[model samples]
Target: MKIGLVLPVVVQHPSTRAEWERTAGIAEVAQIAAAADRLGYHHVAASEHVAVPREIAVERGGTYWDPLSTLGFLAARTRRIRLATQVLVLGYHHPLEIAKRYGTLDQVSGGRIVLGLGVGSLREEFDLLGAPFEDRGARADDAIRALRASLSDPAPSYDGPFYSYDGFVVEPHAAQVRVPLWMGGRTRRSLRRATEFGDGWVPFGLNVDELQAMLGTVDLPDGFELVLGSGRRLDPLGDPDATLRAVTRVREAGATVLGVSLVSTGAGHYCDQLHALRELTGQAGCTFDADPGHDRDD
Candidate 1:
C-alpha cells in the first residue's frame, strides 16, 4: 500500500500529541514536510478548525493551524508531495469558495492538491460561524456535487438543493482535470458519501477489523482509495517487525493508502522515523517508484 504521514505540528490533540510538539513551530513543520517529500511519501495533510469552545478545548486541544495557509507555505517548499486538507469542514464554506481557493493552491502546487472534506460536528463552533448545523449532512452532499462540477471549470455553474449558481468566472481554477475529493468521517454514512461523491475515504477513530467490515459492505469503485491511520502509533524505528505487521494488516483490511503516525522524540528524530519507514516499506516490496515525479532530481 502507498504510505503518507499524519503530519505533525499542524493539529495537536490532547490525547495523542507528543510533548515536544508543544514548542514546535512552522520551521519544524516545514522540515518534516521537506523530509517526507524527499522520501517519496504519497502526500502530507493538515486539518482545519476556526476556533474551539473553551470547554471542548481541553479534550480536543485548541492549536489548529489553518490548512490552506499551512499547505500553501509547504507547497512552495516541496516539489512534488501532494498537499491535503486532512479535512476542511464542508459546512464552513461555499463549494465555489473552496474551488477558487484550493484551485489557486492546485495551480501553485502544479496539480498536487487533494481536497479532504467533511460535514462538521461541533455545534458550538458551527453556531459561531453562523453555519447551519442541523442539515449539514444534506448541505455537505449538495456541496460535494457542486465541487465536482466547479473545481476545474473556469466559468463554472451548478444547481443543487442547498446551492445554485451560474454566470461567473473562477480564474486560475484547479490544474487537475478532476481534483480529488476525499471524504472524512467515522460513520458508515460517511463511507457511503465518499462512494457516491468522492474519490477516496479517510475515516478516523476506527480499528482494522471495523475498517474491514465497513469496507466489505461498499462497492468501492476502481482505484477508490481508503486512507487508514487509526489505532496504534507506528514505530518503524524501534519496532520494525510490529510496524510491518501493522502495515500488513492495514493492507489486508483493504487500505489502498496508509496514513502513518510514527513515534518520535523531536523534529530530527521524526525525520529519521520517516526515513526508516520509507526504507522499511521499500524493502518489504511496496512500490513507490510508480508515483509521478518520485524519481525527479530537480
Candidate 2:
C-alpha cells in the first residue's frame, strides 16, 4: 500500500503570524515538496474549493492561491513525489482547462500527477458561482469524460448539457493520456458514480460497518480502491503486529492506498505529527532513511 499527505490548507486562521504563514510561500513550500520527494512518499494531494463557508454568507474563498499555480511551484521543487489532487470540483473548471493545467504540471514534474475529481456537494458553492446545483453532477461527468478524451493525441470533441467543444487539443500531454482519476466521497451515491466511471475511490467518514455494507452492495472490479483515513492519531507503533493487522483489514476491503491527515493548528501540532508519521510508516513497512525532524529544511 502507498501513503500520501494531505497538507493543511484551510480557511481557519492559525493563532499567530508564524503559524499563519501560507503553505504556498515559495521557499517554505519547496521544503515540503522536496521532503516528500526525498522521503519517498507516493503523493502530495491538493484540494480545491472557492467559497469560504461563513455563517449566513458565502464568499470567495479567502486564504487561497490558485491550486494549479501552487502545484506547479511544488512540481518544480520536487523530482519524485507524485502530485495528486484529493478532489478538484469539476463543475468549476472546464475539461480543456484542466487538461492544459495538469498536463503542463505533469510534464514539468516528469509525469507525476494523479487527478482526483469530484462532483461537489455544497449547494452554496454552486449558487455563489452561478451554476445550477442540480446540473453539476451531470456536468462533472461530462467534464471528466471529456478530459479523458482530450488528454489523448488527436483530441476529441464533447457536447453535453453543460458544455461543448470541437477539436480540442491538450498540450504537454501526460505519460498516461488519462491521468489516474480518484473519485472522492464514499456515500452510496458516490460509489455508484465511481464504479461507473472513476479509476479509483478516495473516501472519508465511513466506519468499518459502513464500508462493509458498501462493499456488499457495489460490484467492484480488481484495482478498484477505497482510500481510507481516520479521526484517530497515529503514534509510532511500539507493536507493529497490531498496527499491521488493522491496516490489513482495510486492505482486505480493496484499498490500494491508505493515509491519515494528522490534524494540526500551530507549531505544536506539527511537532506532534512527526511521531505520528514515524508510527504510520512503520505500520505500512515504509522507512524514512533519516531521523525524523520537526521542521522542513530547504
Candidate 3:
C-alpha cells in the first residue's frame, strides 16, 4: 500500500500532537512535506475548520491551519506529493467555490490535488457558519454530485436538489481531468456515500476487523481507493518491527493508501522518522512511485 502523511504542525489535536508542534508553523510543515516528497510518499494532507467552538476547541484543539492557503504555500515548496484536504467540510462552501479555488490550486500545483471531504459532524460549528445542520448528510451528497459535475469543467452545469447552477464559467478549472474526491467519515453510511459519489473512502476510528467487514459490503469501483490508518500512532524510529506490523495489518485490512502519523520529538526528528518509515515500508514489501502523477507538466 502507498503511504501518505496526516501532516503535522498544521492541525494539532491535543491528544496526538507532539510538544514541538505548539510553536511550529509553515516552515516546519514544508520541511516535513519536502522530505515526504523526496522519499516517494504519495500525499500530504491538511484539514479544514473555519472556527471551533470554545468548549469543543479544548478537546479538538482550535489550531487548524486552513487547507487551501496551507496547501497553496506547500505547493510552491515541494513537487510530486499530492496535496490533500484530509477533509473540507462540505456544508461550509458551495461546490463552485471549491472548483474555482482548489481547481486554480490544481493549475498552480500541476494537477496534484486530492479533495478529501466530509459531511461535518460539529453542530456548533455548523450553527456558527449558518450552515444547514439537520439535512447536512443529504446536502453533502448533492454537493459531491455537484462537485463531480463542476470541479474540472469550466462551463460546468449541475441540477441537484440542494445546489443547482448552470451557464457559468469557472476559469482555471482543475488541471486534472477528474480530481480524486475521497470522502471521510467513521460510519457505514459514510462508506456507502463514498462508494456512490466519491473516488475513495477515508474512514477513521474503526479497527481492522470493522474496516474489513465494511469493505466486504461495498461494491467499490475499479481504482476505488481505501485510505486507512493503523489503530495507534507509529514510532518507526523507536520501534521498527511494530511499525512494520502496523503497516502490514492496515494493508491487509484493505487499505490501498496508508494514512500515517508518526511519533516525533521535534521537526528534524520528524524528518528522521519519515525516512525511517520509508525504509521500513520498503522492507515491508510496499513500494511507491516517485511521482504519483503520470501526466504532470513538472
**Model 2 accuracy (lDDT, Cα):** 0.66
Q: Estimate each model's TM-score.
A: 0.95, 0.79, 0.96
Q: Which ten residues in a row have the lowest lDDT in candidate 2?
A: 10-19
**Highest-lDDT candidate:** 3
Stretches of model 3 off by over 4 angstroms after superposition = 291-298
Model 1 Cα displacement at 175 (Å)? 0.1
lDDT on C-alpha atoms for all candidate structures: 0.89, 0.66, 0.90
Q: Flag regions of model 1 displaced more than 4 Å.
A: 289-298
* Tens-digit lDDT string for candidate 1 (159-277): 98999999999988999999999999989999999999999999989877777788889899988999888367788899999999888888778788888888889998998888788
lDDT of each residue in 83-198, candidate 2, tens digit only: 88878888878788888778877777777888888888888888898866897777777787787767654465777766788965566666665677788886787777777777
Q: Give the better candidate number (1 or 2) by TM-score.
A: 1
Model 1: per-residue Cα lDDT at residue 168: 96
Query: Which prediction has more favorable lDDT, 1 or 3?
Result: 3
Worst 10 residues of 1 by lDDT: 289-298
The all-Cα superposition gives candidate 2 an RMSD in Å to the true structure of: 4.7
Comparing 1 and 2 on lDDT, the stronger one: 1
lDDT of 3 by residue, 106-207 (tens): 999999999999999999899998999999999999999999999989999999899999989899999999999999998999999999998999999887
